[model samples]
Target chain A: MELPGIAFYIVAFLTMGGIYAILCLALNMQWGFGGLFNAGIAGFYAVGAYTAAILTSAGSSAHLGGFDLPIVVGLICAGIASGIVGWAIARICVRLKADYLAMASIGIAEIIRLAIVNEEWLTNGSLGISRIPRPLEAFYSGRAAEVVFVVFVWLIVAVTFLVARRLQQSPWGRVMRAIRDNEETAASIGKDVQRFRTETFVVGSVFMGVAGALSAHYFKFFSPDATEPLLITFLAWVMLIAGGSGNNLGAIAGALAIWAIWSLTEVVTQQLPPDWATRSSYIRMLLIGLLLQFVLQRFRSGLFPEKSPKLRISREK
Target chain B: MIDFINFYLIPGITLGSIYALGAVGVSMIFGILRFAHFAHGDLMTVGAYAALTAVWVLGIPALAAIPFAIIVTCLAALLADRLFYRPLRDLPTIYTVIASFGVALILRSIVQTVWGTDSQVYMTGFQKPTIFFDTFRIATRHIQIILATAALTVALHYFLSRTRLGKSMRAVADDPDLAAVAGLDTERIIRWTWIIGAALAAIAGVFVGLDTDVHTNLGWNLLLPMFAAALLGGIGKPLGAIAGGLIIGIAEEACTYPFFGDTLIAPSYKSAVAFVIMVLILIYRPQGLFRGRLM
Candidate 1:
């Protein structure tokens, strides 16, 4: 017997793939471009999703569900809220280097998650907010709606990618790279390195927020459980590191490859014997670890290594 | 208030000793290797499992299994370092951190696969509750844990201060290159560091399991608290970790008591309490309370 409705499966896969692409790009800009080792991308993503959900869910006639703003507006608000949170964290913790920065960001992310979990009045706690208004609910429904959502998401991804590319080539991007390569040199050139770092952090985080908002709308639900670090944060890190840290396209490629492999593994595992299928999920985690080790060993520079501006421009020319 | 002290304070000290032991291993690894070993928690879990396995499968006594578990864990640590870490020694510290995370995931998966996901209680017929007074009662297991933690801490302090190898480890932590130049065997020191730290972690894990139940997520859940304690005490300072752990543990418990009949603070906020304390300490004194060497 074959699984039915393969079309739905394909659409779902692409939809998830597109959202992850956006998430990876956002992480790429922060870690790849700015050399900020943020371990809290999931926190920001959750913040955006919850922010939109909460804002739109408030003032409703039934169980805090009424404000009813447009999906685009909610998305924008999510971006702004996440940007603000990112900016605040950067301001406080950006002065530290690798290990300290990682610890601080992880701590901040945990705090964000805990706040979301405990602040039942605001977040509705673990029960989660549901019945979120879909964009273009009147015009599109079912598979057609999913297709339209995917297109809209890809549109956002394209716009964000272009903007990020432009920014990376700009004078500001050069200064950011300069700081990443050599902080002392950047400071010697009279660049306010901390401010630039914070700005890059906020901008990158805004993209993550936007991606989260898109995901929330697609799912039409939001929960504190979704904000946990293990779910989204590490996956994004793996994608970025596996693909190529400093390259946006590499991030997208990494996202797609890893997710596809993950999904395919799940599908294949379901076909195994009962005992084997039961243990396969654990084995899959081991495989992911082994895959990471393998990737680190063979392609330390990642799949699509960061290209110099001269090479990139030449290719374009 | 007196009842509160008898109940919360004493129990907090018992719990804190376990946290302190775990933190010492984490802090030492961070000190020498210069990376947050996310796998440290899983190492502890593995140690607890080792002890549990020794008791259940090998028919060893719980007390006897503790030392054996520690030794096995030390060997495991050495193997991990040799296999995974030694190869990446030349890379950036961040790479090591990521690799440690990979190691953690692998260890967790392996444990789950072999033992299944059920919580394991290592009850080697060693269940006795000790009563201190009419109002105060403590588990004999907890008292044993506290005593063992004290003994281990004292032994570790002596070893670090008086032993030549321990001095060499400190030197390596200070500067690997300088230690190498000063005729210290850097590789040997690092191996010893892993052995000692992992052994300590094993002891802590077994002690914790004796008092509670051993579960897969036990180590992962303890990770943040370990970090908090290590950071609160200077990261590399073992004694400071003890003090930091006690302070955090007591504060977490104390905060949960209802003040003047107002709504009692939820116990779920325990992690938040530790986190808040950690953030405050970091903001005020990023170097930590004891202000020892950067680790």
Candidate 2:
């Protein structure tokens, strides 16, 4: 690839990596901390994107696009909408076993996808929401636009990372881990296991929603068809697992590394003949699938395994 | 009224049988192996293509192609079980489920890349609809599906009830440790579960393909409905799956009636019907209608 092409790819990679970073962080909180096996990451992410799209776009009759809200408001609404749905999912599904949770979440994701496709009045059907009110819209284009967006995504990731790190060190975070490791023990200690799980799920989903909103605004397009639930969910899971699930820094690294590899595959696979070119993406999917199994079997704890927080003898000042 | 019966009822029975067959595979896998087989749908797609190959490519009769597809798909599923599922069997349920999802991805991609993403048929060119009493109308293909599914179900029922291996399989599912202590080969039981499950799944896939056109994404598309049927029937209960499948198949199409109203929801939203039904079931009876194993 030429320098400009390389630069463009890097920018694109970071922007998506940043979005996935947020997604991974959310998933890390749920799976790593709370031990909630949420297979519906795509559902929550889609909710966030669509919520942002509906809120910020000016009303038109192409489907049902008349929110015309401010960007900040749109993003927050995305988070709130996602959180609300997540809370419901948690309340209903959290008590189930980890594997069962996976099934139920898949169902949720499927329902969301169907809704996005069928409910034309709410989601604008398949045409999708475009001309999105991106940040610094008039002030930049092309490379400059890419730089600004990457910076914007980086800021979000940074803030989110800090929040997640802080949470990891907090007493509540400890409780979440406790519940995950031993639900019976956590409950016996007078903790409301279900409530904490629900709260953690909501928090993670809120972050996911905000990330989705940013993704929408950056791309300036949103649609149900664009979601691709299973792949998106699997991508986040693979990133978190590859990063070392409980480690915050590892999540960031995993997000970037996995996204880069995925991008490289897309680039390299483009040189195939037309017939092969049409199907190369599926080959990438096949690789990811095999890679997931290999990692799970061999590098179960991931590259940066979760640090078992030491038993601290606290001396309150 | 006759339009409704012919259009909805006959189609419903045929669709239900397919769902039941797939759900049997799902519930059995859940019972013995103890994880939701997410790749079961893709396996069904594999069966469809195998049948397509048997008929369209290999010049086999359409009817015989069903069993050939079942055998071929079973072999592939068996290989997948050994490579992916068997190793993770002793791990946490979550690990196995994750592996299964990965398997789903791999299987789906295999179908897509190998088969190409085009609609195909085992035998094309429409035949005249067969009418019963000049009111109950079903095409030749539909009758074939109904007979095939009924035959499979009866065979499955006999296998589960009258066979020593089936009895042992049930014993293992109930308590693997005790069954092991009682001298049953746990490995063999697991193998049998996959065999039966895969066979049933292939049958379902081929039947569904017969009803419509075969697509690489067919299995992925059916995942939700199959899972819903399996769950509704109760996780480990074969009978429950059959009942659940029938109800789901009927309800999915029937929802376009006064319940949703045609204006309320398009026919394209048929997939959502199963999801909604599953959610409602989970909300009320997470153990499922048959009161099967919750886990």
Candidate 3:
């Protein structure tokens, strides 16, 4: 089995890295900007992916497959659906204080995964939908197409980062920060805490949904198995936490760093002696766990701390 | 209908008992510590494996090995709390939550490294299935598990309500600062909390292993259900935890029944069923079914 070309691998890495960076950014917005600990982002991501796959797949009855909608539309639809779900969850759960919110989000995520698994009519059950259409297949060809798609995804990342940064600086951003820092004080200042949280959650989930859609198109195949809470969800959390939670750039950096590490470990394992290779996957998990522990212990602020806001003085006065 | 009741109801209760024991441990820890310990499931796995090792490798009797497993698990929990959790206790609650994940990862890795990823069954084979009249059948092992859980729950109730140490535990759960001011040794209470909670978790693990195959992922699978139970019973309430566990257990089993003709939900959806129940409870009554204090 010859390995794919280096360019192919690079494109794959960049695609995954970009998608994850988008997810981390979403999480950073919810967790860092809004101080919502969402343990269920993977659920939304999976939902987005499945929604796109089911809607766009060829030859399906009852479900909305065979539409062959443009990739941009599919991506947008994914974001809308996830945003709606996130809004519903927020409305129900935003009132609950910290820790309970985490538990609730985790519960919701598990439920979504179960729904994907059980709702055979809609999600194709455990067999999972495959042969998803690539977005730019008609316009571009071959590896160059892949390279273009990577750039396209990075463009999404760039826009998302810019938007998140803008939101973080706006008045609404200040309100969100205030809520994160102290809800009572924010409320005292006439802020609708729940509304802010709900909006933030919806917006963040939209990004997650878009990321999921992008990822599905890149992979060209998807399964309910991909949506399982443990693998994708936890890894994203690990990335956001490793980077500064509030910093979009840091989230991207962390995604790239972790994905590179993960890819490098996989490659290294494959090259190792056959006997050692078998256990390398478990070793990787252990290392990740250990890395999480070390990071949490040693640098609680993360590699890139969220920069303090710049203050301006009235020099004219 | 009678057959369905006989088949599913009793088995569900037995399963519920096991979950209740695990949830009780989780509730107690959360009540006192004020953070969700994600590693609790792995601790359950460790406990089950510890007992398995004692029986299979060390040649101890199954009955004797349980106590050993519980002790070992308790010690491990205590050590983890002291080394990993204690330092971060003063940090942000999120830090503790993250640390729990780390602890879970580390424990899982250790288990995999030592036991390998392959599933293990307790060496003790079934002696015989109990005959309950002519229509119903029950397993002797399950009967033992249910009875043992009841006994433990009762003992725990008495210990918490009647005994001096139990009162201290409750005091700490209510308000650690006040309890400390009241001259209760808060640190000792915490240590004992981990010990007892871990011991109960170990018992649940052993019971689960007896009922089904034991694997590294067993604890991980149990985590959500345990949380459901704890949340349903009202986060820090011990009795609520037990009740919540039983309810979730029965609900999970019953959900497997065919709702519409020829459309039966699979047992794999048990976790999902638990989550749904939990979400409804959370949405309507965030304080939980029992309305106990938040952990």
Candidate 4:
């Protein structure tokens, strides 16, 4: 590949890697801090992506789109939309045991998918939406446009990272960890576990939605296929767990590392005989699944384990 | 009324039987293993494909392939437990749940690679439904599936209530620590749970193939309804899961009937029926209809 070609490839890689980093951070908030099992990250993601697509895309007769709003507005609305969904799901399912919550969340994701596919009037069915605007697209074109978008995505990732890090050190984070470590003890200490969980879930879902919107903007199109659970939900879970669940930096590292493995393996798989073409994707999925099992068993805490934030005050006081 | 019975009720029962069979496994696993086996649906897919292979290689009827399917699926379930789930047994149940999600993907991918992604069946041509009393019409496979499920349910009831191993299995599910303290062979009971669960799942897979086509997403698509059935029946209560499965399956098919001059819900959204029912059950009765475990 040429230098520019390789640079362009790197840009594309980082853009997706950044988006996935946001997803991992969002998941870290829920699973890492809150200990809530949200297997429906894809649902919130779809909600956000579709919301942005419907709001910011050019007017179309195929689906619900005519607003042609600003990309910023679309992005904000995406976060809000996903947050609402997360709140509703958490209100009902957050109180359930971890396993039940996982089951319920998967059901919700499936329902969301069914609606997105069947409700053609709203989402254009399987045809998907096109002509989604990229952030500041008018200012750049071609490779420059790609670079600009990657920067935008990384900007969001930086903001997300800062916010997540702040939350991890906050008193709220301490309460969340307390509840996660032992709900009964947290409750005994006068913390409303349910309310805190609901808050954490909603907060996490907002970022997941933002990540989804970023993807929509990156692709300049939106489709149900992009919201696949295996790619979005499962990948994010693997990334967080592999990267180190409780630590913000681990989330980003895991996202980039896993995303690299996910995308680069295609290069090798594409070299196989033509007969193995269709089966290669499945082969990758198998490898990824095995990798998850390996990481869970061998690493357990991931590459970057969580470290408790130290108190600023001295015991002498 | 006859149209309702023929078009709605009979298909509902047929689908419910499949769900019931699959839900039994889910309920038993939940009861004994204390984790939602998300890969259970894929085990059904594995069974369907196994039977498909048997039919292709042996030139035998699909029904005749049940034993092979059961044996293959039983092995698959046992291998997954030993390789993926056993080490995580000491950890929290969520780890196993996540691992099962991975297993679901692995199983689905394996089936896709082996069988190809296209939908297939044991027999391609459609068969005419047998007429009952010159008024009631039912497909032959439906009758067979329903009868087989009924027999299995009866056998399961007897095994749990009468057999020593079955009793020990229930004892472990009820309270693992107590069962262990009581000198029950927890590992042995766990093995039986997997065997029974895998056997029923294989039969259900074959029945689904009989009713429709064997596709990669066949079991994954039915997973929500099966889980709904298990939840409705009460998690851990095998009998309750059967009842739950029947109600969910029937409701899913029947809800689309043109009862009031139009269908209550569009057929395209039939899958949503299961999700709605599951949510309602979660909100109203977490213990399930049979008063199983609270969680």
Candidate 5:
């Protein structure tokens, strides 16, 4: 490919990877730090994307739209919307076992997808609520626009990464890890384990919502198909797990790596005839699944497992 | 009244039976294996396709292909146990569940690759429902599904409660440490559990193909509902799965009841009903209606 073409594709891929990295960090907060198994990652993501779209889109008047809100307000509200939904889910599912929590999470995601498909008033039905405002699009176009979006997404990713890092080093983060390491012990020591877990879940969901809003603005066009579990939710888990569950930097690395793999697989599989394309994609899915297995078996702590604070402190002494 | 039975009751029972079969397998795995088998639904699809292939290659009828498919699924389950579950035995339950999710994706992709995305029917063309009692009606396939579920349930009950092997299996589920200490072959018992549970999942998938159509996503769509059934029926009790499946199946159909205090709900919302019930059960009755696992 020519330099300009390559540059455009690279910019596009980086923006997507940055957006995914934000999501991975959010998930790490729940699964890694809080020991919560949130399988319904896509539901919170959809909540963010749709909420932002509804708040900002000028064309959507029949439903909850035409507010024409600023992009920042829309983005913040998207986060709030996702967090609220996560809080509700946490109330019902947090007391259950790990397996049950996972089940409820996946169920919530499917329900969200179904609701989006059916509720024309809320989501514009299957046609999907388009015309979501893209930030800074007035000044840039084509390759330039995409490059600006990449910078825009990276700014958000960097901010989220810093906040997540601060949280990881805080006493609150210690309590979170304590709960994950041993819930019984944490409870015995007077920690409100369940409450903290719920908080972590909500906090994590906020970032997911932010990522969703970013994704919506980037594509400027999305349908229910964009929220499919295989493409969005499961991929997030794979990124988090492959990168090192508790490590933020690892999350970023995993996001880029997995996104690369995803796009490359599509490119490789696209060579097939029209009839065989579907089969090839399935084969690609199979490969991705096997890759996850390999990662789980070999890299149990993930590629960049969490650094033990205690170990670091003692070593310094 | 006949319309209610024909539209809701009959379809509910048929769906319930399919779920009951898969739920039994899921519940058994949770009880004995002590992890949620995420791949159970995909395995069901694999079984259906296996049977579909048998019918195609051997030029046999649909019903006749079932046994061969069951055997193949059994072996597949055994292979999965050895290849996936065995390696992660010592890990936490969550890890095993994640592994099962991986297995599910793998199985689904294989089905998509081999069968392509187009929906397939075993007999092609719809079979008209047969009238019963001059007022009630159900398709012939529905009756077969109900009868087959009943037979499987009875046989499973007999084995679990009556035969020595069945008792031993129950004993293992109740207290694996004790069963192991008492000289029972726990590994062999687990192997049998996988074989039986997986064969049952296969039959459920095949029955679905018989009633509706076979597609790559068939089992994926059923995964959550059957899980709800298994959880509702209690963790390990096969009988509970049947009852739970029936309730969930019926509840799903009723979710679209045109009048909801003068409001309307689309039928597309039917699937969410199962999920809502599952969440409620997890909150209010985690031990399940059958009182199996204490969640």
Candidate 6:
């Protein structure tokens, strides 16, 4: 490939990796700090993507769309929509044990998926929405457009990182960690553990929504297939666990590292014989699953373990 | 009324039998191991494909392939435990859950790679259902599935209430700490739990294949309803799971029936019935109908 082509590939990689980073950060808030097991990241993601798709896309008779709103409004609406779903789910299932919560969340995600596929009047059924507009697409074209999107994605990642870091250091974050580490202690201290968990779940879901919208805009299309749990929810979980659950920096690193593995495997698998092409995807899935097992078995703390800040004390002693 | 029995009720009972079989395993594992075994659906897939393999290679009847399926799936489940779950046994349940998710992926992918993705049936041609008193018609496989499930339930009942191992298994599921303190072998109980769960799951898988064509997503698609049945029955109660499965299965099929004039729900949304039921149960009766464990 030529220099421009290589550059474009890198741009695409960063764009996707950056979006996954946002998802990882959101998940960090929920599972990493809050000890809430939400296995329905894909549902909130779909809500955001579809919300943005409906709000921003040009009017169409095929499904619900035509607001032609600005991308920023669409993104904001996506976050709100996703956050609402997260809050609803959290309200119902947050108090359950981690395993039960996970099962309930998965059920919700499946229901969301069913609605997406069956509600033709709203989401165009399985056909999905098309022609989703990218940010600043009118001002740039071709290679330049790709670079602009990559930069845009990275900017959001930076903002997400800083926000997540701030939340981790905040008093509220401390309360969340306390609740996660020991719910009884936190509740005894009048911390209201359930409320904090619900709050964290909503906060994390909002980021996931934004990430989903970003992907929609980047692809310029939205489909039910894109909202698959394996790609969105499961991948995000792997990234968070692989990177380091509680550490924001590890989230980004894990996203990039895992995303690299996910994408590059396609390139290598494509080199196989023609008959082997169809089976290669399964091979990739197998490899990824094995990698998760290895990580879970060997590196429970992940790549970057959470480092608690040292308390500053007076010199009276 | 005849139409209801023929088109809806009989099929519902058959489907419910399959769900009950699968849910028994899920409930036992959930109660005993204290983690949702996400790979369970895939284990069903493995059993179905294993049975399919037996049919193709041995040129035997699908029903006859049940033993082969049981053996293969039991081995798969035991191996999965030894390799992936045992190491993480001491960690938080969340880690095991995640590992099981990974295991689900691995199992499904392996099936896809080996069997190919296309849906296949044990026997290509359809069989005529035998009619009873020239009023009701029921398929042979449906009768087999329902009867097989009933027999298994009886056997399971005796095992749980009669056998020493079964009693110990129940004891452990009821209270692991107390069971340990009482000198019951925890590891032995865990192994029996896997065996019983996997054995039922394999039978359920073969039943699903018997009912419809076998495909890669065959088991994955039915996972929600199985979990719903398990939750509805109560986490630790096998008998309750059977009742829950029947209720859910009947409800799912019956909801699509047109009562007043038009269909109550769109056929596409039938799957959501299980999820709705599960959420409601969780809100109203988390301990399940059998008054099982709260945790």
Q: Whose DockQ is greatest here?
A: 4
Across residues A35-108, which tens digit of lDDT does each residue of candidate 4 receive?
Answer: 88888889989999999999999999999884899999998999999999889888888778888788888898
Rank order by lDDT, top first?
4, 6, 5, 2, 3, 1
lDDT, candidates in the order shown:
0.80, 0.85, 0.82, 0.91, 0.86, 0.90
Chain A of model 5, TM-score against the native?
Answer: 0.95
In terms of docking quality, how is candidate 1 classified?
medium
| Winner of 4 and 5 under DockQ | 4
- Candidate 3 residue pairs that clash: none
Q: Give the per-residue lDDT of model 5 (tens digit) for B126-162.
A: 6887888888778889999999998998999998999
Question: Which residue runs of candidate 5 sit more than 4 Å off their true CA positions?
Answer: A271-275, A310-317, B257-265
**Each model's DockQ?**
0.56, 0.76, 0.60, 0.86, 0.81, 0.84
Candidate 2: tens digits of C-alpha lDDT, residues A1-317: 89999899788889999999999998998898888888889999999999998889777777666578888898889999999999887888788777667777888887888788778888887888887787776799879988998998899899889988888888888999899888999999899998999998899999999988988888788877666777889999999989899888889988888888888889789988887998998999998898898988888888788986666777899
- The reply for model 1, stretches above 4 Å from the true place, is A1-4, A57-66, A225-228, A311-317, B59-63, B124-128, B133-135, B259-265
- What are the clash counts of all predictions, listed in order? 1, 3, 0, 0, 0, 1
Ten-residue stretch with the least lDDT total in model 2 chain B: B256-265
Considering only chain B, report the TM-score of each candidate against the true chain B: 0.93, 0.95, 0.95, 0.99, 0.96, 0.99
Per-residue lDDT of B229 in model 6: 94
- In the range B149-265, model 6's lDDT, one tens digit per residue, is 999999999999999999998898899999999999999889989998998999899999999989988887878899899999999999899999999989999999998889889
lDDT of 5 by residue, A256-309 (tens): 999899889999989989888768878888888888888888887787888855
The TM-score values for the models, in the order shown, are 0.93, 0.96, 0.93, 0.99, 0.96, 0.98
Selected candidate, larger lDDT, 1 vs 3: 3
lDDT of 4: 0.91
Residue B282's lDDT within candidate 1 is 67
- Model 3 over residues B123-201: C-alpha lDDT tens digits? 5466676776776777787788889988998999999999999999888888888998999987888898898889998
